[model samples]
Target chain A: MLFVFGHQNPDTDAIASALVYASYLTRTGTPALAYRIGEMNFETPFVLQAAGIEAPPRLPELAEGTAVALVDHNETGQSVSNLAQLNVTHVVDHHKLGDLQTNTPAMLRFEPVGSCGTILLRLYREANLSVEPLEAQLMLSAILSDTLHFRSPTTTEADREAVEFLASVAGIDDVASYAMQMFAAKSDLGDTPAEQILAMDYKEFTFGEGDDAQRWGLGVTETTNPGYVLGRQDELLAAMRRLKDKEGLAGVMLSVVDILEEHNETLVASEQEAAVVLGAFGVQTEASRASLGGMISRKKQLVPALEAYFEQQG
Target chain B: MLFVFGHQNPDTDAIASALVYASYLTRTGTPALAYRIGEMNFETPFVLQAAGIEAPPRLPELAEGTAVALVDHNETGQSVSNLAQLNVTHVVDHHKLGDLQTNTPAMLRFEPVGSCGTILLRLYREANLSVEPLEAQLMLSAILSDTLHFRSPTTTEADREAVEFLASVAGIDDVASYAMQMFAAKSDLGDTPAEQILAMDYKEFTFGEGDDAQRWGLGVTETTNPGYVLGRQDELLAAMRRLKDKEGLAGVMLSVVDILEEHNETLVASEQEAAVVLGAFGVQTEASRASLGGMISRKKQLVPALEAYFEQQG
Candidate 1:
């Protein structure tokens, strides 16, 4: 059986895309199973519960050369630890192409959309297959979660059409209301550890090439009520510091996103990270936080800016 | 206008794929012009003549950030000299993924098929567009050339089906005879210069990573009458030496593939390349030539072995 998974720090898109894509693959004669590489975030659990779907099991250790497929993300840093050893047979992502190398030719499908769910919907249509109700609901949830109800700058026409079609199939009458409910569930972070909160939607990236390459950890927590997250700023910063040191990362940042207002306030782990934020976004960091107004999409906004900054430095 | 071109040292598939895909994009609401990054091989000209299509113009000097689409290849080393500065909007290839990075998400469609033409056919079907006769002929010729009329090890079931479908669409009743005609045209290499012959179907690749990376130039010549090519072995070796030195390449090799006989005899530029051939393929080089029986496809048989060897050394 082929194992399909998404990036570590599983978000709603990562989890839902894997599950839907694995189902599609199995229906198309490729026996596959969806797997999660990391712990599910609050938003993902809420989405799954609402869809009435059981959560996918965590990925089990596999022998080298096991066949696998990746969804949502493709970068080695963000994937499974032994990704290089596994035989990656397919990748379906909606992000910028990363340094993903395969030994042989593989099926890679990428499109510039707001979420992987949008691409999966396209796949279902191309294959002449009808999306099941649960699959439709999961895809709808993923699109709403990733694009923040069409508020994110990364939102595209395809994403909007996909959400509309999926909502109809899922019997969701008011997408806006359902999106708010999902956001409310995501914001209900009651007593969760700072480390867990920081890892909810985290990703690791490498910039530059060869000797000049720098590995950085970027985390995001999207919520309708951002006050609760920012209130634990000290604990989050401490968690970021511990992660940076533990992972030997060049820098660490946590962007607390206010979904309703579409704003970002990033917490830096140290002065080095502060410098990176200042250089990348031209924003000053005070009290270990950088206010980035109207810049909330990490994939479209923050990561690209930081990549450009590091590339220029090199 | 968006520029669409294939890799340098354009082969039949590279040239045909760029032309057909550019036309497809234009018909689908995107104005695109096909171009060639380098000189076309002999077979490409013959194929274009058969399809009654004029050769695409050579790529002009493009300014930085010009939107471009890549066909048949994705590696920076085999692409335009200023590829890093160009905005790669799309890539349609059938090769293994390389270190290709884009600032934003791009439409990347890759599959482990025998030729890019097969994937283009799928695109046409998915778009619900009918393929014109000339387009079908071009794709047919490309598939036949790349897969060596279903004799090469790279040939897949999809490639065979595509050939049958394209031949019917192109109104070519005698498929085998037409393939022979194309091969005869490809093999009619008269008194071309040694350097020109070496560059007919050459590609540059970087293996390993970071500081340990080694750049290599691998060229292949597939002809039904391989005796003529084997007779000019010394000249080809001299050309490979000149190219290796001029380009500061780690090594250079020219594999003369006997299309009808299904065998490969590689000409090494120097002892270094000879050693590489021995280590990579377990074939001893005699008089600067390594006889690799039943190994005709460079992408399928040669490059992967060399990549593995270099990676092991690193």
Candidate 2:
């Protein structure tokens, strides 16, 4: 028996990717239990129920020989809240490569493309497993969310191609409207605090030279209205500022994207960091980077520039 | 044995969705052959190859007692193209409802949610099947293309939820850039003739008043760099008008859209049709109905408006 896991505060991509992976593995005669570290949100349950799929039991009873294959997020020794005593043997994630594990007989596949769901799709093919609809819908959802409804630069040729196929099988013709509604649903920040909204779908970035380590947790929060992007900038900035002051190295930016307008607002940690980076890209901005036609997702859209800036700084 | 089939001039959504369905069928115990009536273009190959999947065989030798499934587009009366003699036991698609045989013993599952792949995903789940990677990727791609990367208003809640789930399993944190690039790849129309470029993705829309049956084919041709959109509009319009005059469409509006800008120029045979239909949706016009955000897809985006206008005309 083996276990499939994802990170805490898991997003739609994480949850759905894990479930699909588990389903694929089992269909291929691979015994595995797909589980999450924390409770799945309302959006996840709705997605699974509608697709007629269910999330596997969370952290179910594991045998001594159980091997864990983590999905979406990796355990970088910074936290062990969920698996305090458990052991992970393999990992499948689609985030920036971290110093996850060097000694464990595990594999880490990280690419610049959008969702881990895509990676799982690759694995399914490599394993020669046939696809079923529950897993298909889950993987499709994961890609849509991670790519921000396919509006992110992190998306790849594979993504577009996959979407074309899925469009036929899913019986959906107006994918844009469906994507809008999903984002709108996730962006509705009712009762949730600014911090919760900010940290809801977050990732950490570590750039520049470091002796020990320097990491900046970056996240993008969406809103129902486009103007809400401006409304939450200050709160998000302050949070980034606190992290900047605390970490004291490199840049940490929060991007507020206007999905419909095809525009973005990148909130930088410091004017100097923005200055250093914008010069590399031939822009001058200290407040928020607002360009109408540029790509949105912070991961693929902004990371290359940030990396180039770090190289320049070096 | 089963076969997966789709409509003519199959768009990315129709083709990709069929691929996913075929993948699902093969992954399970049921083996299927994916077949199409028309041609496959440049961009589609990339998505299929990216996922290491193949489109269905066009004219595979079938055995007796073979079953076929209809997806995305369907036709009757004159013995369908890819499936003339086979037992079409199931019709799983997302299109304007057509004249399906009332007494045929077939499973009919159709929904209007932008992409047919979304419905196939549901069908797979209801049947307790699994969604493997390649199929998942295809379904996800279909959703993006059908939804215009999630910009149309016809997307349903079920479609939205399924896409969210699929993204995770596909395993990318960002998809927008991937979609944009795919669209951009298709957008490069480089000196091609107006008619050929337009046929890159042209579909027949059936509309009529009483006994008068009209079929209008709408398509778009794009170019890169300076004066690209307007420069090609005239030639494109002239070509479409030729079809309009020949086919006797009340109007054939080719909404030339700048993907990055989302602005489109609608070239129509009938100004009143553009006025009554496109105008009702707030599409701006310089010569014909134009809009900054007018959708480009004909499936869910245009059919609704056309149907509504036709209904109102009666």
Candidate 1 at A308: error in angstroms? 3.9
TM-score of each: 0.94, 0.45
Per residue, candidate 2 scores C-alpha lDDT tens digits across B1-314 of 67777766666676787777776667665687677656665556656776676665664556644677777754452125425446666666655334433212244455556788788787567556767766777887788766656665556776778778777778744778666656766665568787776666766656655566556676654322325645777787787788777877666766666655555556665565566554446664566546535555555456656755665655
Model 2 Cα lDDT, one tens digit per residue, A1-314: 66787776677877887787777667777677677766554456656766876676667655544467778765453223434245555556665434343212233344445788877777666556766666777777778777767677777887776766665566657767767766776666555555565556566656566663445656565444657656766776777777667767456666666666657666666776567546656666745654423656665556556655665666
lDDT of 1 by residue, A86-122 (tens): 9998999999888888878999999999999999998
Top DockQ prediction, candidate number: 1
User: Per-prediction count of colliding residue pairs?
Assistant: 0, 94
Candidate 1 regions exceeding 4 Å error are: A207-214, A245-250, A270-286, A309-314, B207-214, B248-250, B270-279, B282-284, B309-314
Least well predicted 10-residue stretch by lDDT in candidate 2 chain A? A99-108
Which residues of candidate 2, in runs, are more than 4 Å off? Answer: A1-314, B60-66, B75-86, B220-229, B270-285, B292-297
Complex DockQ per candidate: 0.85, 0.01
lDDT of 2 at B30: 68
The alpha-carbon RMSD over the true interface for every model, in angstroms, is 0.6, 24.0
Best by TM-score: 1
lDDT of every predicted structure (CA atoms): 0.91, 0.63
